[model samples]
Target chain A: MADQKDGNDRKTTVLEDLKGLKEVVKVKTQEQVEELKKPQETQLYRSIFRIKHDEEPRNRALSTLNNLFFHIHPAKVNRDATRYGYTWGLGGITFYLFIVLVFTGVMLMFYYHPTKVQAFRDILYLENDVPFGRLLRNMHRWAAHLMVMAVWLHMFRVFMSGSYKRPREFNWCVGVLLMVLTLLLSFTGYLLPDDQLGFWAVTVGTNMARATPLLGHQGPFGPQLGMTPYNDVRFALLGGSIVDANALLRAYIWHCIAIPLIASVFMGVHFWRVRKDGGISGPSPVMLESEAKN
Target chain B: MFGDWHQLWVIISTPDNIPIVAMLGLVPFFTWFAFHNMLANDRLIAQLEADPQLARTHHRTTYPYNSRWERELHTNPFLMRKELLAAIIITIILMVWALTLNAPLEEPANASVTMNPAKAPWYFLGLQEMLEYFDPWIAGVLVPTLIIIGLMAIPYIDANPLGNGYYTYHQRRHAVWTFLIGFEAIWLVLVCIGTFIRGPGFMWYWPTQTWDPDRVEFNVNRNLDQILGINGSWISHILPTAWRPEAAIIARALWGIIPMVVYGVLAALFIHWICKRSAYSRKIYSKMSIIQTVTMYIFLITMLFVPVTIFLRLVFRIKYIWETPWFSI
Candidate 1:
């Protein structure tokens, strides 16, 4: 009887303590409800929380973007692969150059005019008139040069690594197309300045176009220059008798707009395919043989 | 076939116009397909988690990374210091360089005037030089096409299993280095020689005849007659042929032979040398298969000299000492 009574008293004391604690919590929650009722108080608290946790939310958004974006391969890149000359391989550098081109090209578009009459003047204005215009142009020019070089290096890197082997043959062909497009982009851009250098360069370049087999007259075993069918491929390229203003306009459009848009499309596909094909393979033995011979 | 009204929604909603609209229409169909696969994976994970015994067995091996490299910047002390510093420095340098130099701007473009010394952009100069040697058909179209096709075909053709890097180069060093070094050396020489040598004229180099003003005038008259269509001679009448006042046949012949001979000898010597270097002999050659990569700077310097020599020869035709001893390729 004594033990039972002691247990009951102990239980009663514990319950009373719990009740007191519950009352305090109830009051606190009531106070929170009152604050929420006041819109300003709610907003202040929300703002304070946001200020404190802004970066966390931003990081989450960034991660989400990474998850969603299709171009990037989802794999964690190798952090310690510096056996080659650079930390990131040649492909990474080329990608970096592409980024630069995109950024600078956007800035340049503000001032650039695609028309034949204004194209030359706009280029001149960028060089001589605009503040930091010269630098922008220079950067654009140098970046273009570097982009080509990096791309070539990337191709060589892929070639030497034997990355193009087996299942990647189609992708390799796409890459080759990308390389040609890069050169074509550079060539068309060269004509944009419309200077003596640009004009003559186009002339000489187009002259070579005239020599194309089945297309041009300078074929090894085909129609001569003044034959029955005057299949002058060069004439067609110029859109008339010779390389005139029309050719310049065409080159400009292809350079500034068409080629870039096409390259971007292919680039997206290229990057996605790389992910699908399994992230880049390590160097193979064939590369080693090539190295040894060198 | 009945038209679907939903296609109109796709066409309107797509920001990139009609083609993008068609592609965007795939999203819902793909979403449904992907959702099924995702549910399957979820179910698998849930099943593994629900059974305590299975969870216990799988937990140890299933989790890919217990510890991973922190992706956030400034997380790793060493990496933060090195990468951040390097990126800053390089970006600044590039930006500054871009800012200072005004890009080249030439005179207003006119298609009418044929500018003398019409040079291709520096990067295209290699191909331009090649055009002079081979038929333009070969140089411009056939060669470029071949190069592209060859590159694409590489992956399929070279299917050796030594991809792990340990075994490939250990076998075939001779063929690889021979191809690489020989190719580079030859291209470098050809490009260099093409740049330096100007038009073979009497006043510039070995004179076939003493500087005769009267002979030049006579040739000029003949050239004008050919241009004006006054000349009835078959050679002049048939096609436009600019009269060479006094150019040496031997000099012209030498010009053609020297580049070929030089390239041939270099290629042969490189093959022979690499054959003897037994220590590094490997079957799969690397991109830089030989040490001749160090020689590229020399080649670049020589290429610069070629253009300079050509310019000097053109300006000072009478000055023999200034004239390059090398003939035009």
Candidate 2:
């Protein structure tokens, strides 16, 4: 009978030990779940962009490819290209300025009309009434001029580097085309304000346009081509003998809508080809050769 | 006043301009950063060779250890840094600039009252300055066309392959000289003259001279015709006939050829010098062949001609060095 009683006590102790072990396992699992939930707040953000902290380069490339914003750039760029010295960021700066122009230009349109009378008044209204209106006009004009200089400097840098060889030759032509477009856009915009500076400046500019050789009657050989005051490139451009209400309207549409669209297309081609052309010519053979000797 | 320079910055920093100022600030910062990076890299390269172990780890050597990644091969430290830096820096600059300076606004548009000097916008100041020297057609039409064409043709014509990536004076002397000279002589100098030197009458006024509406200078300019007393109507001056437009015109046209002959010879001799100095080699001459050589030389000389003609006008008041009914040479 004493032996039976000891057996009962040992069995009960074994059962109690099992209960304790189960409780410990349950508590540890609950603690792990809570710890995991702590990271979820940050994970919400990381998951939105599909970015991971420890992603290898493969994911970086995948991220770049999948994202619309990153498409303009390669998945990876050469460290050399990152150095501020090489291109002087002129090309990139020009692009940024263009973006600035687009943003501010749209703002100006809200208060502006292409008409001769309304154009100046609208500018005045923008300056006085609309919030931050004067700022937009100033930034737009400044950036327009700056973009012209920046593009030229970019071309100069490219020329100096001789990056315009072989594959880039066609792109160079496209660049020149873009420069012409930029000048035209600026020229047209110059007259839109219709101030003493704008009016007279456009007078000088359109008069030059009037002298386009094959296109205008005022130009040399224009008479032979049957270009006349009534029917010439200038007439088509201005819709009149000189810069009038019609001229303002024409410049307005071109400045606001037309040229920017054309520029956008060419710019797309320009940026796309930059990638195709091996992403900005790395230090070429001659550079390496010179370095080796040094 | 010198203080007027500061007035340009009295931008009336309203909320609207904050964006513009921010952008403007970024530009200078970006420029500074670039120069800083260049100097640092030079410093790095200077030390890398001294320590072979450092050089071994750096991509300064032909190979790098992280061969598994193509990015390691193509790229250096990183690129995303630059992209982000450029954006952030520009944003900051535009923000600051807009917060400080006011964009300029003048009176309403008046078609009736033209500004006295009636300047074109600054970009076209170069062309406007040229208009003073030549006929409207030549300065406005022909020159701009030629400039665009000439710029387009540079890559195709330039055969020197030695200076592809690196900017070196020794290897690419011809290209460097051509680009710098063209930029300085034609574009930059003319723009300066138009912007700073031109005054109310579209006349030459030094920067020290203020633009005064009351100032009236005389038209003391004497053309070649008047100086020589070669009145195209008065044949009695040099022609055998009495006062007749035809005889006087003939005599004047004949005299005009003299300068042409002088310039022609000068151009030829210069072309010869160019070919010889380039060692008569096709490789380093920027272009090959006699025709290409002659054309390039003439283009350079002609670019120089405008400035020289302007100089003669300012100093000697000489006009129509060579003249015809259609144009002047």
Candidate 3:
């Protein structure tokens, strides 16, 4: 009878151990739920975001100010500036298209070869065999065309709103240079496909460079200046007398590396000047002719 | 008529030509949209100007502004949200465009075989079209340089401070109109012509006309000196025997220069007249420095030269107004 009682005691001890394990698991799970409830308090989230995202006015401003990408924008803007009618969002759209171009352009570069023998065949292979290759090429080409149109429209909007006036004058000049760079970028990319359309188009384009005054072989006084097909500006442009293999390679370098770097530098100056010129030239109070200082 | 329509369809439907086709709709719509907002702002300005009390108290923008609401909004959610939406919309449009249309890849670049209507990309078409009226140096190099300089010079040259931030046609009529003429009447129109009108041989064809490679135009084009029957023989009589050989060249050069000089003077005077037309415009002109005035005249006359040369080419069939051994205008 004493042995049976001891066995009963052992059974109760095991049951109590199992119950304690269940309680521990439940309490741990609850603690985790509590921790997840305020994810902003987590070290990982804190380290990355740095600021708590909240409905407070300070946080709202901090959100823009603290972020590297968003910091290009001023924390506060004229309420009227948000209206589509004033700015038409053209400038922003152009910048976004550029970003899109860079992304897709990088992807395209992975598959393309700059040499004459390989360039055409690469394009064909990209279109036929590689998944989403056609879409990638189409996006790059169309986005390029879109970017040109956007640049024009942005200029138009700025002109219409007279945003180019005053302290913004130098910025406008920078913008003009950027516009030229944009066109050059598009033009260089035109020859990359190495197809008949691109080849002929680039041929005609460089042909005009042959007529650049003082620098071109066929231009006015060019021959007098001792310019020739071998040494004129066009030769320098194409890396040779004609749009051959070297021309293809030169175009690739310009389109991919050189111009983009230069353009990015100019773009940095353009945006910086915009801020220094007192944010966007405003949807501010219209000054009357009678109120003119001069 | 059906056949002609089909030819136009082919041109318009070409994958590469799609951007120019899209431009037809986009340019006009945006232009109208700009004018519409500009007109509204002008009306508001007029209203506020008439009422001194209202002018003092009124919010200047066309957008609704409640005094109780914040004058400035945080860029994070307020502006960034709209920007995000715009980016999304643009992405959708781009995706659709990429899926629907295939980028053109004309049979691998053959150097031996040339495209009958070989053309520059659509954006440079304006410059290419200018080649028809001017020398390549002028059209391709000088003009593009001038355009860039002229555009950059605008802010400095414009003296009127009335329309700085907002859109208003009344206060800045001259600036607005000049930009419209330059961008719309000249640049955009020339691009359209280059894309739609020029066919095989880069010859002018109506929108519906077939691109016949063999078609030839018989009209004889002449220079201004040729048409006027001016020659070196007459000038040689007035010169010494030693200068006789160069008389024809000098005469042709003079003929070209004289008219251009007259045109330049006339155009300058016209611009001056316009600038001084209204009380407000005169006020604006008076504010401009001498340097600004001269720079303005240079760009204005050059801009006017484009249309004048086109007129001479198309209507009078005159090739070069000023012809020399080296260069011709």
Model 3 chain B worst lDDT window (10 residues): B1-10
lDDT of 3 by residue, A176-273 (tens): 99999999999999999999899999998899899998899999889889999999999999999989999999999999999999999999999999
Error of 1 at B176 (Å): 3.7
Tell how far residue B305 is off in model 2, in angstroms.
Answer: 2.0
lDDT, candidate 3, B1-329, per-residue tens: 22599889988998878888999999999899888988999999999889888988888888887889988999988899999999999999999999999998889899999998998999999999999999888998999999999999999999988888888899999999999999999999999999999999889999898889998888688989999888977788888889889998989987788888999999999999999899999988988899999999999999999999998899999998899888999
lDDT of every predicted structure (CA atoms): 0.51, 0.69, 0.91
**CA lDDT for candidate 2:** 0.69
The candidate maximizing lDDT is 3
Q: Please give the ranking of all candidate structures by DockQ, highest first, separated by commas.
A: 3, 2, 1
Candidate 3 RMSD to the correct structure: 4.5
Candidate 2 wrongly placed segments (more than 4 Å)? A1-54, A214-218, A223-228, A285-294, B1-77, B220-245, B250-258, B278-282, B286-295
Q: Count the backbone clashes (under 3 Å) in each candidate.
A: 28, 20, 0
Give the range where candidate 1 chain A is weakest over 10 consecutive residues by summed lDDT. A284-293
Predicted complex 3: CAPRI docking category: medium
Query: lDDT by residue for model 1 over A160-198, one digit each (tens)?
Result: 444565556677788888887887887787777777767
Chain A TM-scores of each predicted structure, in the order given, are 0.68, 0.81, 0.92
Q: Considering TM-score, which of the candidate structures 1 and 3 is the better prediction for this target? A: 3
